[model samples]
Target: MPDILAVLNGVSPAWFLIVAGLLAWGAPWSPVRKALMLIGPCFALLAWFATHETGVYGVIDLGPFQLETFRFDSLSRIWVLVFILIAFINGVYALHERNRMTDGAALIYAGAAVGAVLSGDLLTLFFFWELTALASAPLIFAAGAPMAHRAGLRYLAIQVLSGVLLLAGAAVWASQTGSWGCDAIGVDSAAGVMLLLAFGVKAGFPLLHMWLPDAYPKATGVGSVVLSAFTTKLAVYALARGFAGEGALIAIGLVMAVFPIVFALVSNDLRQTLAYALINQLGFMVVGVGLGNELALNGAAANAFVGVIYMALMFMTLGAVLHRTGTVKATELGGLFKSMPVTGVCAIIGALSVAGVPLFSGFVAKTLILSGAHYAHNDLAYAILVYASAGVMELSVLKVVYCAFFGEARHHQVREAPQTMLLGMALAAFLCVYLGVDYRALYELLPFGIDDYEPYKLNNVFGQVQLLLGGAFVFALAVGFKLFPLKSDHTILDADWFYRRLGDGAARWGKAMGELLVHAINTALTAGVARLRARLFNLFNPAGALSREFPSGLMALWTAIMLAAVLLVSYFSPMS
Candidate 1:
């Protein structure tokens, strides 16, 4: 094992993914399949740790291209570690899956995300940026439905466009700075805007976030877990690296934190609502990153790390419900605790954690971000973030657990989730508790030292608890008064509409123009053919060629006379 570890230390992240892809392609039912699935991510984690002491990855220069990058910094380590853990957990969740395509796509997606974070150059980052698109597209298609297919296409288009923007930004930045390495390039130029837009699209920043909710709910159970971890976090990391303190991101972050709460409030599909909620959670981290202070950046990093765990925990609980009930529509689900007590309990823990209840993972992580907001002295932003936090509790953690599980078992015969699923949820639930109670390890892993960071301050803890309870009270009041807005039947418009409708519109317009051009060409061709035919007929059937004229000899003599007259006329005309 030591020798193997030594040998593995020399391999690149890309090579590890390639090997995983090959295994996924070749061995569909190998008994060692489960072990093989985790190898790539484990390798990535090892690679990340190998660079921890050095604080950066060794630079590899390809002639004029220099890659000044680090594999395991404080920021990158947390994310990469979460990515690995997500892969491992998702693999466990998906162990019973029979779809090789789904498994393959999941592995590639995980590996690509890990590679993206570990990239040392802008060119390398762009490579993995596009790889994420290629890997995740199949997960959407793996749903095996028409809606999934359409959603997959739209998702692919959005991701590809993001990749294009990233590449364009990399090109511009490389030209201007004469290097392709990943550094703290300021966001004061066109290149910076392009890069920001690219990350924004991936981060699901406000209107650009349509692809997330549109596609995530449609993915398979395991697919949703995988989707929850990588793409947006990568965008946050990029923003942390490239656009920190840009001021623009502060506004962008504000919009991100607030808008999704409204949509989540009105959404019917439980998973879709969670998707909206997910964006809101990301918004807090985005604001922290934009603040660009040590505490703020550390909060953003910590939020992202804990957010992945809690997000996965939430999704797993919901997914288990969907798996057992065959539906996740909150309107249709109620009273499931009798059959699924274990899952129900696990879900409640997840919900409380997300709600930032006093002693859960969310409490430890989210408070860091809220404190950072307070430190930044953006009272308006802080207030909105506070409101959004309560909104998350109201819509997701509280509503999902109370309405879906504990209310009333709408269907009495519903079986508890499979033991495997419960086991997975339990593991995640344990992490949520362990991390919350003992967060010293997590805090130390943050890039900046927070010697004075205290999450247990009375004002902070009581304030967050008050918000949660107040939100819960409001929910109760709304339910009691029948004032809660019922879930809408129609799909609310999202950023994906541009690609779905706008792309469709552009395609329709192009087809119309093509038909017009084809008709014009056909008409011109027909006219040309008609003129040629007429000319040929006139040449073949000249006048006075039928029997109405005279015999052949008479006709010949007349032709000779007409030729002589023509010659005489020409001679006279010239001579005169």
Candidate 2:
């Protein structure tokens, strides 16, 4: 057999899991199938660990171009590690389920995302890009509900459109630049514009963002956890790779970061709330990419890294609630801290991390971006990022913890999640604290190695604490004023309303108006035809004009006079 390390060096870790995922459907026994799910990621992690240096690894020479499968560099290293970590955690989380489709689709979706991250060229990236879209759709579809079915179809359409845009942009780029490499192609060219749009579609750029919040919450509980980690982050990876430092992204990112607060405030479903907050969290990272300094890039990478864990931790906790309680809607849930104390604690930790409270993972990661914005002298953007960091994410994500676990006991008899699920949340929760407190581990994995950026400085910690307190106060004020939606049954129409309801409504209205117009026109035409028929019958029917005919001689004389008159009229006519 070939050397293990050598094999790892040459193969992308994704193949190990992708192959295993394909084989999972054929595994005759449940035990062996589940084992494959766990083992696949472990071996992929081993492959990730085995690589010692950064360069292209698996280069395929297909007739016209070379496909670089594993570009294990600093930037990709962080994303790949986090993805592999999530895959393993998700596998542990999903161990209780026996659905082969979810099992296979989740693994393949994850592996495809990893493969896309490690892709060195546009050609290779596009191939894996489409794969992720295809693989992840079934996870949403597996929810076995009409809503999930519709959401899954929309999700697939949007994702496939992103892939098409990517391929088109890459083709245009190759024509202009004569290479398929995915280095920093800025927004000055047409191809760059297309590529930014493609990535933006996935990155949750405002208006292009409906696909995320629409589908993720509607997916199966385990599916939501898996869906949360990969697709959007992959878009961030693409943006960092291609459109870093584009000034326009700063404005776009802020819009993305800020707008979700309103929707989250009114949302009823905890999972759906988290889905909106996902867009909010990603905006900060997008800003980091736009700022595009080493510090900003590192911040983006760090945020993306920890964002995965904390966000998944939050999703995992909510998923657990969904698992036991059958609903993530706030109106139908309350006060579960008694029975689900462990999950409640985990939820609180996840909330703290999301809120960027001091000594949590979010604080450590967000500091880099805030500092990056400050050092870059982007005061306005810095202020916005700071406010969004403190204000939006805290209120949005923390509500899940409060309403579901600590509010009021609407679900008293609900038991704890399965063992495997708790273990998943446990692993994710531990990382939230560990990465926050010991941020150097996360910093070291950044695209830029950890520099003099100390997150634990007196002012940094104090400021974040102050911000956290202020945000808490606002949340409390909102609650006091009855502005916070702790237990709502409302279906808040977000940007998604335009497509899901508004667009559908418009089409229906148009069809009704067209039918009305046609009916009116048909009525007028029928009336006119009836009037003409009656006039003709009155004038020339047998008992009308013909019954009053004169004698033949008088008729002949009249005819001769009429013929002379006709001849005179014809002679006078211009045409004659």
Candidate 3:
């Protein structure tokens, strides 16, 4: 058994899933495809667990260049485990669907993300990084919506741009150092900045984040669930790996943490709102990355791990609603708890976890970030994050829960989510509670091993309670004052305003101006040509001076005189 396990340690968990994904495309039966979905993640998890210690376990040679394929260090250990776990849960959530393309795409996408996390060199990372983009785009296409197709194209473009930047950064770094290793790249050089931008796009950095809301909600129900698991988190992992302790990330992360709550508070689309909330959660992780102490890095990793489970849960619930009711619009949803009791319960649990209520995964993970900020002496940042979590994030979660499941009934009668979906949600919800109770298990997996950390001191617990109570008070006040706009059919305008509305308008205006300029130039050219033609006609026509016939005698006399003059001039010339 030990020998078999040792051999397993050398192989990447990613290949099993990638191969399974390719096989899924050729699978003839639905049951087999579903089993394949479960098989890949299960086997991947097994392979991940088989590793007893960390090192560069797998290397590939390409002529003169050696590629480090599997760097199973402490940083990648937790990331790989969570990715495999989510991939399995995602598989279970999707068992009711019958789309082979989605099955193949989701598995390949998950594997590609894992491969990127395990990569020890820039060249290896670049290969898997771009593979993730190519593999996941198909999930958006699987939605079959025209909007989805357009969004998928945009998503692909941004991801390809990220890849281009990564490749360029790698080339520059290699030129400078004669190596392509992935470690401790500070943002002090061009290559480092380029690499930062590459990671930022996928991490949902503030201005670069429109893709999250624009694309995820537009994908199919199962597609949305799968989409939530990998991309942004992968970027977070990259940042943690390459640029930990980067000071600029502090400011960038602060902005990411705050602004999305406003949009989430007003948006009608449940999944879209959750997408905003996703960015909000990522902000906390970013702040942790920026802080970059042992505590801070652990916070970032734990948040990412817990985040996948709860976010996947919330997405699954809304997806179930969309599945049965065909709309996640707040105005169109209500009284769903009566029928979809399991899903509604799951949503509320997810909402609590997201709100960082005590004894949940979020509370445990989020406190680490708060503590990180506090310990760093960043008083302002700590205050703002706490305020965002208590006031804004809590309020947004309320709106999601109230509007989607318990508010005044507007329309739709629906059954509970399918059995597989419930099981997936239940599994995630269980983790949420389990991780909160046993956070030490999570800490043990972090890059820096934990030592006597206390998350549940009396002061911290009471402070959290006070915030929860205060947030509840604010929610009541908003409802009583009629200030909360919890229901609408409009999607929140975000960076898409610049990318879509303004960009489309600009393109059209440019095109129209271009055509007008071309037309005016052509008209001027035509007029000038016509005038030139008329002038030529007047000057050289048969009735004109040059065209008139001359007398032969006069012409011959002129020719003879010219010849005599030319001969006299040539005789007087020195060298003629």
Candidate 4:
């Protein structure tokens, strides 16, 4: 009974979301929605503080099957806490949404996400992994546009594919190992590759990243916030659990970090640029996991934790711009600092955090990953990562802040964001500062020990500053030299090109082939039946004769013969 009570206590945080989803569904546009939004996170915070480092494991026995385990360790707690916090802030931010369906979907999405991180067994993790997809699809649909509907379908398809892969890998591992434990699998096996592919798809690893730009811009402000927090990070967590240190991930991570910078450089849409940037940032975490050292693992986990904040901050800032100025296109927006000072400042803070500027959350978190890479003695990987870091400063953090908020005013008399939105952004911004300054606490929560990490080392600080300054100088030089490429009217080809254009093309071709087959079959059947009828008619009626006259003559001759035979028979039968 006491054990049951403890489990209930540990899971209490999840119930808040359950309650919020129910209220959002049943209640109308009232304070109840707002209350549920605020109350949900408050309960999560309370639960996080109350739950201790007990290292307790809950097990359920199943005959002939592996026992189901639900355990709380230091490593899982960090992610769980972050998931809870993000869910709350996202809920508050989404309060401006008029659609109850969006609110409800966001809550369920949050719940499933939190559940995924807290899960202890592979089977449990798989269940939450799929639930997240089911819950988040509605948010994409809530955009209330035809494009959004199509994008939602595509997004759902990809997410389902990822889930299917995860389940298949889990099933294979269970059958081979006779355990459903969520531990690292050997990279030599098919199950490991399947798991990697599953995580890769979700992590937006290189070519698999199409759904991000396709779906994020189509989501509502609140929807974007929810979307940013769950899918990729969950995939990262799964990788950390199942395929950390796999050699293939190193190459995959490098591709992820480098390719997106080029797209972000040339792209005009601010939101899409950010989406590309998100993939770039995820590469750092992937590299850390591939390194497979303690510091590297810690770095990966820390990156996941901090990535949530910065990603949310970026999304919120962009979402605010879309809400106030009515668009997020770089060509359409300029100089919003005149009126929306709060939003402008918040956006800059977000930019700094993402850029890894000193004393921001990103600086502390990203350095750990880079340092881990160095510690692992993968100098080539480290060098590539350094270049990518400079690219991050150039493409996104600086470009977005300067172009969108610091230039000439494009709109006059624009108002600030709503109070709830501002509050949410402020809270996230505050956490960014808090995490940056008190990184020691964050460090301690990492999955691996990092005795050698010194965030304020002279070489580290100098290199980061040099990179940031160099990136800025390059940007200025490009502008001064008139080397900045003109924004093209055409869409840059990306991984989604194959799926969207090629997939659509394939569908059209299939339809055409099907139509041709149907036509050909119908023609052949008609011809065959016509030929058969003609042959039958010819056989019955004869081709040349219109009428037959021999039938009456033959009938008369036969009757005469029959009469002669009857007479002969009567004469012969006289004796009778």
Best by TM-score: 3
Give the TM-score comparing model 4 with the true structure, all chains together. 0.87
Q: Clash number for every model? A: 4, 1, 0, 0
lDDT of 3 at 156: 90
lDDT (Cα, tens digit) per residue for candidate 1, span 1-576: 566556545344544654675588577674456666767667765665544253445466768676543455666767777777777777776666667787777788877887778776788788888988889988888887899898888889899999999999999998998877776777788998898899899999888999999989887777787788788888898888887777877788888888887777677777888888789888888898888888889888888888888888888888888787777777788889878889888888888888888778888888887788788898988888888886554565576676788654576578888877787788889888888888887798887898778898898787887888888888888767877665445577776677678978999999999999977865654463556545555665667364243234434555787999999988889543
What are the Cα lDDT values of the candidates? 0.78, 0.88, 0.87, 0.78
Which of 2 and 3 is the better model by TM-score?
3
Q: Model 2: how far is 345 from its true place, Å?
A: 0.7
Better of 1 and 3 by lDDT: 3
Tens digit per residue, CA lDDT, model 4, 1-576: 455445556554555675777687678875677678778777766766666654544454666554333356766777777888888888777677678887777877777777776667777777878888888999989888998899999999999898899889889988888777888885777887787788789999888999988888788777887898888888888888777887778888888889888887767777778888888888888888888777778888988898898888888988888888777777777788777888888888888788887788888888987887887889989999989986554556667776678755675557888988888899889888888888887888887767567797788878888888888888877756867653544468888999799989999999999999977865654463556545545666665462342333334556787999999999789684
The stretch of ten residues in a row with the least summed lDDT in candidate 2 is 546-555
The digit string of per-residue lDDT tens for model 2 on 475-574 reads 8788678787554487877777887889889989999999999778656554635565565556676766643443344445567879999999999999
In model 1, the Cα lDDT at residue 57 comes to: 52
Q: Which candidate model has the greater TM-score, 1 or 4?
A: 1
Query: Where does candidate 4 have its weakest 10-residue lDDT segment?
Result: 546-555
Residue 528's lDDT in candidate 2: 38
Number of the predicted model whose lDDT against the real structure is largest: 2
Please report how far candidate 1 places residue 257 from its true position, in Å: 0.8
What lDDT score is found at residue 207 in candidate 1? Answer: 82
Mark the 10 consecutive residues where model 3 has the least summed lDDT: 546-555
